[model samples]
Target: MGVLGQPINFGVSMLDDKRQEEERLQVLKGYEILDTPPDGAFDRITALAARFFQVPIATVSLVDEDRIWFKSRFGLSATEVERAPGLCASAIFSDKAYVVKNAIDDPRSLANPLVVGALGLRFYAAVPLVTHDGHRLGTMNVIDFEPRDFNAENEAALVEFAGLVIDQMEVRLAAHKAIGSLTTLIKTVPELGIDEVATVCAWTKKILIDGVWYSFDEFLSQKLGLTITHSIHPDAAKGF
Candidate 1:
């Protein structure tokens, strides 16, 4: 018996965590950002973070299932690293900032390779890149060769940088979706002939999808990542 007179099912807890991770990966894939070329916009963010924190390394890290991919990096040559028990992997578990002022002395980070190995990382700080719908994608990271104290103000600034990163990601995702919709619209118009200028029904609000009619609500939710609801406006109701 446990807290609520039920057995503590550790396996069920693990399964829940696994399911959540699967959903988070699905959200990450929709961004279409993995393995893509670097954007100057993301690069600028990393550069600014390094300068702002006076750290030797700063990166926008995306945590894939087995690896950490650097979308943008400053003062670091490698673009990725294995997903281990330290750094971004550990940071993504929480929404708050993760800081290790002195990895050499902190029991939590003492055994991490980045500290014990040749790179000799002494300091680390990061804020998780969380989506608007509450999925943690990765982290905005700052690293240093020498340990230093990071106060509350510094954490707040890092959090703001994370917000900027997520903002840019959302903008990019919207553009990607818009481009896809435009492409579909163009392909459908030619096949439908000059008589039909659009693939959507004006009255029913149904869209032509692969020669089949699908509700506009379905199209928006499936293709554009939008949530749909039904309602009748007073002005529109008068028409009936």
Candidate 2:
């Protein structure tokens, strides 16, 4: 699967689906994004989504094990809602946009608390934030109190919005991972001077510590607690 390309892993056996769900949740956890502080990037996206859709609410929602956590919200007060099969939970099942033009008449949402209760939600549309590895993380969605038509163009635009959300997540995850690596490196080489990193043989890529040479990769794994893996780059694999 490509980051902003085709969808995958849909329509599988029930048992395989269960395993996939577990893997999906693991991928979500790896991001370490849940329950974190608000981010301006996400807030801006949701705000733009609300304005573009002319809706009262917009959100970047992440479906956790028991709740739908809002990474950012626009025009909505509550930070999160319980994970429900009728709402964001359902949206994450596919890469396509999920919509309810009129929740009052849509059987899928007829009994939902947000639809029948105080919030009185009447319209909703969402595009799932699917990762490059085919894991559906959550959604970039808009909500309205009144029903309205959502055309194909609108859906296409929403998909783009979802892609943006995924792109942001990818950047954020890389940053976090890099920081973690750096912190580990610093701790591992505490005696190294501020201006100097580690003593390494350039050609061999081996680090020297206390007169012993160690493979840079092994040194990182042993001293920094890092796991390294090799794989083809996503773009390069496209040629096949």
Candidate 3:
């Protein structure tokens, strides 16, 4: 079935809806994850996905304007591939999982270079990585050189794994925002002539001020002479 620009084939739908595409791209960019270095958190999940599905390749892919970049991968050396003819491109159109039992037999993928060219991809299954607000960023996918079928159980597992991937993305985004806020706090606040800046742990959210270890709030209160209060909601706390 064709939606607006092209026919949907190979269990893949074209992500060509102009307005929606723009919105999706905006949300994807908000994560600030594109073109980032691999992390053990994401890499371990991809590796486990490959092992769980018994597939040779698995990846956490982020769909960009012109390419599908692998945030994490197993058994794949390349970091990214062109968007056209890419299975993950189609996977991003919806929040549901997309599966191709045999790429060679699927009209949408028969001509795909990844299927017939050097990589020789065959079986494929991808669960969309959807944000909490319902934007689909990309996919958590498994691949094999030989054609194979994926049962409903397998699809469910893939979806769960995809959720884990999304969770990681959320954590990374949160950490980034926190750092940005910290930077702003440092710059905007008046200089207290505290000549030496203390060491801070980004991951642990611990700060060292005046040669003493303190929680983020303690550090802020001690250094900036500011009062810190937290809201029950995490997002609400962003204001402080």
Candidate 4:
């Protein structure tokens, strides 16, 4: 039996870890948030987490291949660190919040460089940023220099904050899609003649092409042989 009184199942744990990592990477890529510029929305959440938990460090961390990058960080200088020997990497493996009261005392974390090295992180608590389809993208975590107990209440608050982060991600994705749709509409405007106007419904925003009325996107695809794609404008967010 392990410290938690459950049998330590190494084989099952390794298999599940592999499967979860594969699915997680796919879902993480879909968000299109990796290496993106910092946003106020994510920054506010991390700042609030640090204040609420009274911790010196907090972060909105996204676990990418080989390294975990901070989308937003409070009380930390380095933006990223290697996946191994990192608490946040372990946090992403579970659906619920993961907490370690003291890294120096925990067998799993005692050897971690962050625990014994310069950073000397002693306390850690994180809630996995899970998607609707049940993939853990990353974590929202708080760290402390001294060990501290993380109760159920603390976990709940962190989970709620993680939800807010996901909400912002979803909104940004929707906005990007809308911008792409609008750009495609403008691009397919079939070079109107001096006095010619394409038949379009003001209410529905559908266009009449040939003898049938079709949705703007569908009309463009069918009439102009163009595919609707999301493209970021140069003046907008630097790169999509």
Candidate 5:
């Protein structure tokens, strides 16, 4: 997580490993996220931050192991960047806000391509998006072409906006997870409905048993005791 160790001109996986690609994909999937379209809430936050700080570009970035991907970007639609030594990378490593008043004067960021390259970014400030579970997700930040100080007011506003961005991410993931669970159940039994209490009970028991098992679905289909036709009521069979 330290910025010093990360690469300078990265293409993809910084660490070379035979299994790292699979591991990387797993890491991306663990969040149950990847290749998703941009969300309005995230984009709005970036755009508003750009206007508020008067920066030409603003972004909500997620730092993967080797690259930086933009969840939402303003004044730009870049997909990824090398996880090179940059102000944002340093901020993520330190788990604190990075404020580079003047990129040319700041030795730490002076050599960063974003500052020296065609983008010509000068003033940079970013607040780290540390998750509630303590994961260093990435940063919410804005960049401007001018060298200027962000007063206390501006800095505080940036941090507050960063928090909102994080909140939106958390909410989005929660909703996605809820929808996935519901979908799984519906696939298991197509007639799933609130009034169908008996089916719900059966599904619940089967899912519970599946949790302790490696091949839960196969076991459930064989032993869940769900009949294709419910003509013989469970209660009637037991004389309950």
Candidate 6:
């Protein structure tokens, strides 16, 4: 019976943790962004960041409830990973910035899948993409195969680059939210419930906004690498 009482306290703590997580996640989701098919603008940015730092990989990653999704990537991959296994998860721990100079050498990254897995990435530096209102959307990261160090100048440069990434994310959030409201204007305004209707409504918002400008793919291209061209087929052109 005493142990049963202990469970009550544990339950309260769990609820507190869950509430905290939900609030944080709401802030993350409030950006009303992340995870769509693709876009040219986004691709360009990630590629440029990778090349600028001379790293083999770069990503604009969003830490979702269960997974860290890649909005853009330059050198290596686009697949999602479990949130518990993400190094960028640590970035959300602080208000500033985070870096992992050598993945294999550091205790944090020694077991990170992005390091030991197929990509063979040994180095990482993550700059959080933060909103002006202080919402942390995700990270702008540069990954490399060799163990190395960045001078003060380089760190400064990466920080600046990360700022640009945040700029894009802010715009994306605005665009997505607007689209979502407009679509649901035909229905009802969506709130926090995870009902299927709400999810679909959110997606509808995504499609409308994406088509208006660049798709998510185009945004990622510019963010990842400069080489991505946002040209569309003559018939497919919708004036975004």
Strongest candidate by lDDT = 3
lDDT of 6 by residue, 1-240 (tens): 111121100010111467767876788776655567665667888888888888877777777777677778786443555555356656655455567788788997776655666556677777777656555666777877888887777777777777777766655665665555534542442331223332223332333222344344432353234354545443223212
Candidate 1 lDDT over 118-215, as tens digits, reads: 77788989988988777888899899889999999999999999988988887677656654675576466564332434465533546676677766
Query: In model 5, which regions exceed 4 Å deviation?
Result: 1-28, 193-240
Clash count for each candidate, listed in order shown: 0, 0, 0, 0, 0, 35
Candidate 5 lDDT, 68-157, residue by residue in tens: 777888976466676666676567655456799998888987777666766667788888775554555678878878998888888789
Query: How far out, in Å, is residue 197 in model 5?
Result: 22
Computed on alpha carbons, the lDDT of every model, listed in order, comes to 0.74, 0.74, 0.76, 0.72, 0.64, 0.60
State every prediction's TM-score relative to the real structure: 0.73, 0.73, 0.80, 0.70, 0.67, 0.63
lDDT tens digits by residue: candidate 2, 1-240: 211222211111122477777888899999999998988888899999998888888888887776677899897666766554567656776558889999999997887767777677889899888888777788888988899999999999999889889888886786566556654666657554323455655335456766778674666686557897867558335424
Ranking by TM-score: 3, 2, 1, 4, 5, 6
Deviation of model 5 at 121, angstroms: 1.5
Q: Give the lowest summed-lDDT range of ten residues in model 1.
A: 6-15
* Model 2 lowest lDDT segment of ten: 2-11
Q: What is the lDDT of residue 187 in candidate 1?
A: 64
How many clashing pairs in candidate 1? 0
Model 4: CA > 4 A from native = 1-20, 190-240
Off by over 4 Å in 3: 1-14, 191-202, 208-215, 221-240
lDDT-wise, the better of 1 and 3 is 3
Worst-scoring 10-residue span by lDDT in model 5? 196-205
Candidate 3, run of 10 with poorest lDDT: 1-10
Best by TM-score: 3
